[model samples]
Target: MQKSLLIALIITVIGAVAIHQFGTALPAYAAFVLGAVLVAIALTVVSNQPSSASNAKYSGPTKTLYVGNLPYRVHENEVKALFAKFGPVNSVRLVRDRKTGRRKGFGFVEMSDTGADKALDKLNDYTFQERTLKVREARTQESSGDRD
Candidate 1:
């Protein structure tokens, strides 16, 4: 645990003990002050806790494949099923338009390394639903700084 968090926990314990022993003996306003201090310590601890977004990036290598030329009416389950023929699929994410929420005709498929390689070789240019599929490794999008 972090040092600041440990210190805050120790302070909280001390405050709880003091309040329990002297709550009634001490003046009403004094008890409120102690309670406020404990609340502040709790808030500090919560704020210091790490956020999920901070750890969103996968640190290790991932076998994520970019799937293009998908039929607009294609479903995520269909994509998963198609790739599952190659290996155990981890996940499938279909791209969509932000405003209309319409399918973007492309998406990503996550699977085992061997599965990804097989899918790339076999699925690329493979016809499905009258469209030739474009299967390849998903490339990290280049960050575009401030748009405005």
Candidate 2:
């Protein structure tokens, strides 16, 4: 993160200098456009670099668990905390309606396989927030589509 920030700062300074030096010779909009292009290029270069976190591998297989019957008010952090009791939670994605930006009463949780199994055993049909939870392995796109 620091490296990316430093690169962005350097790019911004260079762009400012270029604009200042050539502002008199070019139209006002041209200088602004040049700065915008430089910033875009710098961001693209920074984003293309592999993230260090992505290179690390977990000791156990990671499983994506389906968590359904979630209360509409339940958020990602709540789901993470509930699952964290069994094992490390890598991520929690509570699905939401794009148009309304509201929770969709379901979500996906990623954790180690062992943890996922434990969670499924304990949480399946568990009452949470006045609703019975449906915890199980998340179906792959192909399998889910075939069912439909």
Candidate 3:
């Protein structure tokens, strides 16, 4: 339906017609392969058409939120409850001062659904208590940084 896709489809039709017209010059299998390749190229080009959501960086918004400026008293259950309004949460953890057992002022929470995107859109830049939340897709450590 997109202009680019339409153009690609048109080109594919033209190429198919051309191939059929000249296809007798080649062996049957070779002609078949060539036609298949052309069709594949056309589909690939069409599929590359940009989407409106292409600008949406986070693939999963609600799955994991990076909580910053968390109050020392905040618990994992409390955080889960806050996000649960959007969807079920799989897990929540406060990245803490492991030795001191003190809140690290930040943590990560994972929600169960792709609905995280919706939750993120709704809750991003929102204030919980005095701290504004920054919700985003949780990147695997390898992607964001080295885990070790």
Candidate 4:
């Protein structure tokens, strides 16, 4: 976003200098205004996109929970609805196989720390879709041996 703003400012300055030197015609002024508007719209939309790391933004302290034993049929919305009962769910990410794009029977959920604690207590070992769910605080994955 900062980068985008910087670029926009630079373009505006150059445009202003060109207009002042050339004695801007009506069409040139209109084009300048239209271009600025279009750029502003594009920048606003591009900057608002969610980051890949965490889709949801929590207002308070957040916790990420590891959810295991998910049914193959389960999905993000269902996980979110289930967790929403305990507290505001930040995000639900169901793991999928890279090649097959199939559910991996596990995922992660983010929420307020207090809400996450409640969810862990109540949902762990709870049966859902004929499978027992395993809910616990998520641990960072260890670095892979092959990765540089």
Candidate 5:
């Protein structure tokens, strides 16, 4: 955008010089003003975009649990029930295969921060559904080119 603005400013200055030197039309001055305004607006927009590193901060729902060893038929409601005892659940999602639609043995659970911290402290290595469930604070995955 800076490069484009530099190119545009140069073009506008050249046009202004041409109009002052040899042209006789008012529209040339208007064209220069329009170009200048466009360049200013573009620069403002570019400066306003968030830096790529800014997304390092948490922005969405808090990760309450990184559930693993989930049974194939375990549904979202059941997962919610298991953790609802800790706190209000924000969401429960069962990771599934694209084609087979089978459980991926792991999923994410979101909850209020208060509940999340408690669950993290108490649920690690706890047994559920005959499997030793490992729970922890979930980490966000950077853009993988596949997501909502």
Candidate 6:
């Protein structure tokens, strides 16, 4: 918080000095434009820095896998066929739009614990229908709200 305040103070001082120095010499609009540009540059510089908090890794184990980047025409049976080679699949759910009843290009697959691990290892980033698949352990929903 202190660092951000210090940076803001510094930017304000710089912008004020620039506007005061050039406001009389140049047009009034030029001073405002220069202040705007300086503020934008300052914000861009601050936002571009990477922070460690955004690098968190998933720690929980999951038996259900999320399959993404699927073709629109792909069905649940096709997904099952692709994953069946890894192990016995328990269930395959292809998300679809309720109003349109069309595939949503993503789904969830549940399998035995060992089978899920095997499938995740082998199929993650695997190419399907010319697109790389993003297969990962599905995060469980915390809410018990109506999902019908």
Local lDDT at 103 for model 3 = 85
lDDT of 1: 0.81
What TM-score, computed on C-alpha atoms, does each candidate reach? 0.54, 0.60, 0.52, 0.58, 0.52, 0.53
Once fitted onto the true fold, the runs of candidate 1 whose alpha carbons sit more than 4 angstroms away are 1-61, 142-148
* Tens digit of per-residue lDDT, candidate 3, span 83-109: 777766667888878699888777787
Q: What tens-digit string does per-residue lDDT give for candidate 6 at 77-114?
A: 78888887776676789999999999898999977678
10 residues in a row with least lDDT, candidate 1: 52-61
Tell me which of candidates 3 and 5 scores higher on lDDT.
5
Model 6 per-residue lDDT at 2 = 77
Candidate 5, superposed: residue stretches over 4 Å from native: 1-61, 143-148
Worst 10 residues of 4 by lDDT: 49-58
Inter-residue clash pairs, candidate 6: none
Give lDDT tens digits, candidate 2, residues 47-125: 8988653233446688999999999999887888888889778889999999999999999999889989999999999
lDDT scores of the candidates, listed in order: 0.81, 0.84, 0.69, 0.84, 0.73, 0.78
Writing each residue's lDDT as its tens digit, candidate 1 over 34-92 gives 76687687777898888743223434434989999999999998998898888767789
Model 4 C-alpha lDDT per residue in residues 1-148, reported as the tens digit of each score: 5887899877765665566557665456665775577667877887788764234466899899999999999979899889988987888999999999999999999998999999999999999999999998988667334466
Q: Write the per-residue lDDT of candidate 5 for residues 1-148, one digit (tens) a residue.
A: 5787688789677766665556556566776786577667866797788865312333445655788877777888888877767767767888899999888988888886777878877777778777777787766566434576
Error of 5 at 60 (Å): 11
- Best-first order by lDDT: 2, 4, 1, 6, 5, 3
Native-structure RMSD, model 6: 16.3
**Residue 86 lDDT in candidate 6:** 77
lDDT at 26, model 6: 67
Which sections of candidate 4 miss by over 4 Å? 1-57, 142-148
Candidate 4 local lDDT, residue 110: 90
